[model samples]
Target chain A: MNYLFDLNAFLPGVIAGVAGLIALLIDSYKNDHDGIYGLTVVSLIAALGLSIIDMFGPVGEAWSGMITYGGVSAFGNTVVLLGALFCVLISREYLKAIEHEFGEVYAMVLIATSGMLALASANNLIMIFVGLETMSICLYVLAGLIKEHKIGAEAALKYFLLGAFSTGFLLYGMALLYGATGSLSIPEIAQNASSNLLFIAGAGLLLVGFFFKVSAVPFHMWTPDVYQGTPTTLTAYMATASKSATFVALILIVSKMLPAETAEWSEVLEVIAIITMILGNIIALVQDNIKRMLAYSSIAHAGYLLVGLAAGTPEGYSAVLFYLLAYTIMNVGAFGIVAYYERQQGLDFTDVNNYAGLGFKRPIMGVMLSIFLFSLAGIPPLVGFFGKYLVFAAAINADMIALAVIGVLASAASVYYYLRPMVYMYFREPHKDVPFVQAGITFKGTLIVLTILTIYFGVAFGGLHDLLASYYSGDWVTHLTGN
Target chain B: MISIDWYLALSAILFCIGIVGVLIRKNAIVIFMCVELMLNAVNLSLVSFSSHYGNVDGQILVFFSLAIAAAEAVVGLAIIIAIFRNNFSVDITQINLLRW
Candidate 1:
């Protein structure tokens, strides 16, 4: 192991951390909290630029293989930063509307991004736990930022309780794995994978933690309440950026670090994926609240991504990557629209009937949201269709035909609930005579860009897919751990 | 010297107690304490394994877990306090503004 620190390898995380502190410093003096927003966005863009640049550069392990930041990690970092960027852009209107423009929100988000970068780049189980905790702690605070709002505080409390409990599971799993394999480095653990019952139980327990983070079935009870109770902008970040980071960590571990254990675990994951898909979509059908409905749909989407993980192949890895990109774009856009049209700031504007005549009132917002929902439902000519296609295709290619069939049916069932809001928007009469808020340029611009990307990526994602499919120099499987 | 099995078995027992407490305890603060217990149980196992194998890595992990667990407790208590400010109680059942 080298004694020197690889400063360049850790630059992205450094940028976010320093920027978060700087924002907090600026927030202290600026009584009104206006300056911090600009500072936060600038830092996020800078981090995004660094991540993209790193993607094109050379790749290798850093800090004695504690971290690796090239290839998929680079791509994941860029996606997370971009998600943060969009959330920040949409949040300005929300905080202003609610008169809750606390500058600490931006600082907290930057810290969260820093944590995410650490998580995506982790090579050891200990590193993964630390990164996960840092990010989770920040999000617990962000969920209840509106301190006076009971719903926000409750969301924070519930999320904290569930999150801490899961962390306990995660830690115990790590302990068992360490006892069985005698190491915390994932590659070392992989190298020592045996059919011993201890090893299998340790791996199973480890997955229990990741599943909770991804909000898979049997571990997703807190998602709806947290999503509905938290402010919409924060909910957008939690649903998209947070979810993507975990998927990246999960894919890296399951596919790269622990492929030897695939046979034992993939079947188990397949069964779990089937259950998560069926439960998520079926429950969503009855939800009247927009945030809660999207929360359930997000669980189904996690199931689809898990299908790729259960395949345990390089193609499965790439498919999960592409799916996360599509999921981030569409999910963030959907939540952004919800944040945009919310009538009351603290209260969730969730009745299905509230969307009535929305298409006629604001065609741009309605059409944009419709396209996002369509993309989510696996409708073609949208990136979300390709997201589902690549995953189920990978599952089929891996000879899990039963899992593929279940995925298709669950997605088909999902389309019904996805279109319910559109039906109310274009066909029915609104129940409330609510006054309209003027649409601003930034709001329209964010929607138009997301809509364009959804279609553009749908047709043009093959190149990106191939890029993700290409195994890289820094990949733990390819060259690291003295393998 | 105590055998490692004793430590592992004790850790497992304590871990189960923590899980059951979290499931049954209604007060948020007590639930937080249960989470701490679970974490400490893991720490005990980690420390036992580290000593048995003569490996410092497991000991280092125990240290990190201890620190992070403290940080988590801080955040959890803060959130619980925030909720208490609103409703004067931290009973999990009392905080259901956005239930299914």
Candidate 2:
């Protein structure tokens, strides 16, 4: 039981963690906002680089098998770090505009990023639980950052209560699985996996916990409220980075721990996916508030990712990973623009009708917003469409053609809502004058990078898709078992 | 000399009570307490299983769960206080500013 202190395996999380502590120290002593911001950006970029390096490096366990490095974990870390980087870049402007700029925000973001990194690479249930709690607690506080605001308070309270409630189910599920299989290590659990009733129940509860965190339907009631009430930029972090981390962990659970021989789990996931896709898209169609609309859209996106998981093939899993990267890029872009709009002084700034003629006022933001929305709708020649294409193609390859068709139809129906705000922005005449705030250079530059990524990945997604697909080519299981 | 089933059944009942309380309770504090009860119920089961299996993993997990629960309680209580200050109530039904 020798423990390995593999620095590369833990470097990304450790960098973020140490930076968070230092940011807090600086906040208390110097209270320099720019200093904290610079620190966050530097550490996140360094970690992002390391994670990319890990993506190309070897894949194996570290720290006595508490976590894995390289390959899938590295890929997941890259997405999470990318999401956090964009969110932090955009947050300073938005927070200052709202007159709530504080040093603690940077610390919390870094700490949460650290937690997400841990969750992404976790090989043991203990690591997963600790990482999740670490992330969830910071998020609960961040949601209520504007403590004086009533909606922010409500959002934080709801998120905390529901998050804690879900943890109980998750822990109980872990306890049961450990009892049934006599192990907590994911690969070992898979080795001893069976179709017994106890194992099935534990797995079901585990799925429930994962489904709740990912905001799947029937467990998604908290999403819109929380997303709408939290500060727009932080909501982007929650929507993209946190969801990517959880989905990656879920992929590991489904591929490694769940019994492969049984079709029952995949069947259950398929039903949930269909329901999630239809219900999420239908509900999103009616939301007038832009933030609420994106909230429902995120749930719908989760449904599409679940389709890949339900396919239960390596191809399906790889598609899920690729879709996660595409999703992180476009969602952060959408929310970035939303935060930009939110900074303008108007009570109804988030209302879709208020966006009329905004396309004429700020041509760049208007166009970027349109691109993000179009990508979200899975339109052709955009990354979002390719993401949908890969997931559905994987489903079809796995003989789940009906699931793929339903997914296509649901996304097609979704085109209406995604376009509604674009219509307001471009087609309609200005009704109310919401003064335009000048966005910082960094914010604009980040959006430009994201916009480029959306179009570039749309056209040239093949190589990235192939790289992700190679991670799951079956040898990693042997690495996990230490063979 | 008691069988493990008795302990498991008791733990299950406690867990169900916590779930029901969370669903039915209106007070945020009460709901938070219910969530803690659920965690403790799981802790109890973990302890029983640890003894049954002669391994310390379940007990170690219980300790971690306790620490996590404590952290959650601190944050949850702070949030509850913030909400209370804003609205003068911890009743979840009254906190519907962002409803769809």
Candidate 3:
């Protein structure tokens, strides 16, 4: 509980910022591609390394009850940094293709990632809003970075406008909660939970805003359009990093701030989760675009994550963390292939038909994408199934039997659409000769790491479960109750 | 001449109007105005709650929220301008390129 400026608390942002500066400087210089990419990789690696150290090392102290730090905060940041690294790797060919490429995409991502890190560790409501905006504003621009393209500009507009609307709701919700509880610190809010109409309305509005961010049903109209319209690499970043940050924030609210009123929030979340899962998977079945399919699937996966959230236990939170980790790997890997195909075909053939006979045309990339899709569909002995298993079990443990049933049905419904690309690659005949683009060393390195992690988590589930259990062992609630 | 409950009720009605406007209106500028309305509703409640609690934190939050509302207005309008330049219309329905 020492109160000197903990370098560990700020080191990740510093690293990301400094790395971003280096990339920016390189862009201003000789415009050498290798140097820019090389510097970016090095800085990201350094930041990744430092972030990992802070996570496993001693790093947090209670900041006047506004914030506390420990393993859980570090774990979330580590996930975000890993996401940033993969995003940088995937952006190589994606940015190069649209002729609107700039080194600044890397900088924007790193800066936004720093914002995410800040958010994960936020203990104060003000800190939460600041971090949320920081993460979101960068993504808003990144979504439309292709300023010259019609779709890209439109996507950016939609994201920004809707994002602002949701933020308004979120802020108002926070205000009502503050009025009811007379506190803005999460711990203090939990300490003052009331069942008044104002409190209920506030919490309800707050969750509606979060559901929009997580692309849950009824608020998910923005997902497909944004995903399909934005550059593939940025879509992957949004699908992963934005989703992770929001889920972590949701976990904080439910686990720390809403315990006294769990029944109310749980009921609301149950309905949202059921609708999200069904609507997401059912709509995905009809998608012809690979990117759009993944977008809907991402929504479905958000539903699965919500199942864990509704459980209202430490086990549920940990399961969500694990599932998000698994989802990141599979989803980003699928989009990695999309980026690759865009480079090879000189067009983003998100259409399923364009993937016909890609299995033979580019066997390795095709196979990897197939693996990602299968894992996403919850194929057994893959990472995604494990993610589903942990979450569903947590729901059942909490006696949310009906929710667990809905989750299983959605996973089954998901299989048909997820396997469509694989069917195209393996079963259909080639219509034309599509040139295969060579993945640079960086892209290959990322794919290899993600694939390994996906397989490892799928097979070594017990080890991960034990690790997560220990990581989440702290009794924050007891601390709140002064027990 | 109004009771606290009446003021709160008025604020709630104004807030609902704003939320409906945001959800149903497609004109970018009008939607922006609705967002402003929602913020003002919260401000109304915050002021009343401040007097009720006899505390100043709620008022301080009101000031802070006003600042944030201003910031949001600036950013939202800037984005609207960009969208207009690209699409030549403020009708949000034309922004359908990014919707499902």
Q: What is the lDDT of residue A150 in candidate 3?
A: 72
Best by TM-score: 2
lDDT of each: 0.87, 0.92, 0.80
Error of 1 at A429 (Å): 2.0
Residue-by-residue lDDT tens digits, candidate 1, A405-426: 9999999999999999999999
Q: Candidate 1 at residue B58, lDDT?
A: 88
Question: Model 3: residues >4 Å from true position, as ranges?
Answer: A1-3, A17-40, A57-62, A260-263, A346-348, A474-483, B1-14, B43-75
Model 1 per-residue lDDT tens digits across residues B52-92: 88898889988888898888888888888999999999898
Q: Give the Å error, residue A4, model 2.
A: 7.2
Candidate 2 local Cα displacement, residue A182, angstroms: 0.8
> Which has the greatest DockQ?
2
B32-87: candidate 3 lDDT, tens digit per residue: 89878887887888787777767775677677667667766665676777778888
Each prediction's number of clashing residue pairs: 0, 0, 0
Q: Give the DockQ ranking, best first.
A: 2, 1, 3
Candidate 2: fraction of native contacts reproduced: 0.85
By lDDT, the better pick of 1 and 3 is 1
